[model samples]
Target: MFFSSDHPKHEFEESQQCKSRDAICYLCKNKVSLVEDESNAFYCCQGCGSNFHKDCLTVTYPKCHEHTLTFIRRKIPFPCDVCGQEFPDEMYGCLQCDFFVNRHCIYLPRVIKITRHSHRLSHVLRISDGDNVCGICRSLVDVGYGGYSCIDKTCNYVAHFHCIIRFNVWDGKDVEGEEVAASEADDVAPLLLVEDIDGESTWRHFSHDHDLLRVVEEQESEELCQACILPTYKTGKFLRCKECDFALHETCACLPRKMAHGLHVHPVTLHVETGDGFFICSVCNQYSCGLMSYKCNQKDCGFKMDVRCASFVEPFNHTALPHDPFYLGVDFNEYIYRCYGCRQRSRFTARCVQGSIDFDFKCLNLPGLIKYKCDDHPLTLYYDHRGHNSGWCEICEEIIEKGRIIYTCRHCFTTLHVDCILGKYPYLKCGHKIKVNGFEVEIASNNGASRPICQTCHRICQDKHVFNGKDQVCFCSVECIPSQACS
Candidate 1:
């Protein structure tokens, strides 16, 4: 007991790398350094040693292993220490207790301040009876990923972590983040410093009749005014009134834009207050707005119109009628009358009566009906009606056919149908010349007598004969007269 005796030593084989008497680590093949609990040896530093740290070993395993062991021991399963849930196999455990914790979960921040929300949010472990509903949008967060509620006990202002952070709930503005401008704010135009204002005027084109003007200060007016026309109380943003009531929709104030109209294939440009008093709009038949009229600027061409009316397409169809649509034409006459076909009075000036007839002939295919005779049979014009049809022969009979039928001779009152006399060429052999609108005609023959025979038909005229001085002209019927011959 009084003397300190040297510890008993053990000898190692020469092939072994151990310099001292000690056990070697099985994993690294290094010599064990120190003894633990009188039996277990420290095989390496605590990190690499077979002997685990108290906390680390207690978390991984329920009980500690015996000292001086060579093999690593298996860890036990337990609830997660951080999340209070069943721990995964890969989680670190404690040897002293049943607690186990995930590495990432241990370092997760407990409280986060988000820029989207108005209040700080804290990590919530679980829902409880004390927790209130979310303050924003009044919804309940019953389960995972909830945030810390407000300090008031009765106030159930719990918000989800996603609701607060994802939506940036701390931001003072609304979700759209639009900024509101101050009321009655003044907006000033930017000032340009010029070397010489006079030099700039030289380059400007003098297409407009008005003098060059510059803007002074912003004016507040609800009326949409034009530079050449008076102002009116119309809701529009464009309001410029320096020259005259010349206000334009901020859109129409700018000119020379290319546009298409129904009247022309080529694009046209805006023309403002340039034409003389006699200017006529191709459409609408009205005087166009001085500031908003559109015209085909082509030289020597007469097309011009208001921008609104020029947009109407040609051959326009209306639900009211089956005939071809007509547009109003400009006529400067004083008296106004309704068109026979359209039944509408002229807007600015009276339309010509000739326009009605011209429209019928050109648009309605009516002239063709007047020029061509009926296709069913050949008929000669006659005032007298004596045949089977309704027409009358002036010399003898009472009635004739409506279409084509026999008529009396002008000189002898002899009745014959087209088939009875001419055989085939009734149109050519007819002695009378046809005329438009049913005017009377005279037939003549070479020999003078009370009645004369037609040279072409070789028939004596039953109707009265007129002398043309060169020959004794005899009329069988007015229908036998040729239109050219009568003319």
Candidate 2:
């Protein structure tokens, strides 16, 4: 089926000279045949090779050298223009374009504009002198594909796509704040503008909620913010003007969006205008204008919040414990007796009341409770020392079962609550093997060590009995019970 330049009718033979056997000519099957003519010919079949004149083969495949007839293969590796990653050899590439891009970079969208700028910017293949530099850092962008640049010839501002989209901007005047009546007002407010840092033309405007926004100007002055009372800066998101710096962080500007207090079962909803006077959040004990707080919108429940405390998420980040955090929900029940984790009386601690009923208190210890094999028992539920006996439980500072006669395996001394032991625990110390009543149990020394360690907790075990003929059976404590047994 294959043909060569000199012997058109001969069957093809593997070439020892060719280094790449996997690479075949696109048109022919028997490694591409090389011809001595100026135009080298690559033959696929004998019929085609004999039909094509020597001149035709020369036109298709040209020889580089003059004296010898040699076949040469060329492989090309091109680098991506966008991310700079290289493409594979012999990969399809663009010949006419200088910007060599891999397949991944080829799909990138041609244009994108961010909200931080007023005028729309387009993606350009090459840098120009008139392009705007970054508004924030004032830097030139050379390689980023997803970015925005100024279009004006005079401006040279550009910004990373992510930076422009993630930032929140605010004008000094229109942010949320308390407004005093004309009789109590001391001075007039100043005009404030929120403009894109790159160019001066674009500005942000507030269409709704006007009363909370105000502006004031002063000369070299610093004051506690009328809002949060945190120090204010002249040009930052939260500012007190030099004329009369009355500042608030942009986050603080929108206060009391939602809140729930410990004192009441119902959650309070706060708005910018309806709050009465200054109040404090019952949860965190921070003061606020009491505006925009979550209060029992109910008439009979007289609970309230300051903006600062009302916005806190319940189950918010707790440093002392390792459990999933949660926020206090609305509809709290005040009658709950004690904290779930600490067991302290609920009246003293902030009890999260829900639906007028106190639910279980939050704690980190409750989630890991399960069946485990103990040093003393075949299978048992793992009980925290704190929950077994109140005294022991208190000393251990844990909550599963402090000081009670909990169920445990007699052989391993593994303790568990009756419910956890009967409902969950089964099988060997490792707990990996299912226990058949007739299944054989074996006891052996873990290696030659006098005291073998439990695989689960990695603690030394005085008992060296491994179950189900497993290589190792020692258990340090009840917590190391494995869920399944290896065969």
- Please write out the lDDT profile of model 1 over residues 294-364, one tens digit for every residue: 66655766666554444333343322122434433333333254433223354321112222321211111
Q: Largest lDDT belongs to which candidate?
A: 2
The true-versus-predicted C-alpha distance at residue 296 of model 1, in Å, is 1.7
lDDT of each residue in 1-487, candidate 2, tens digit only: 2334334343343232233434355322334434444344433332322222232222221111123221111244544444334544212233333334333333333343322333334444344444534443234555534344555555555654333333321111211133422212232222235554554322221212222233333333344444443334442454323333234445555443333333343334544433223344443333333224456556876555444443344444332222334333322234335444434433323222221222222221122223243332234223232343422221123444453334344464444443233222111122223222323233333335466656656666543334332554544433344444432
> Mind sharing the TM-score for model 1?
0.21
Q: Which stretches of candidate 2 lie over 4 Å from their true place?
A: 1-77, 81-92, 96-99, 115-118, 130-140, 143-148, 159-224, 231-487
Model 1 global lDDT (CA atoms, 0 to 1): 0.35
Report the C-alpha displacement of residue 376, candidate 1, in angstroms: 67
For the record, the alpha-carbon RMSD of candidate 1 to the native fold, in angstroms, is: 36.3
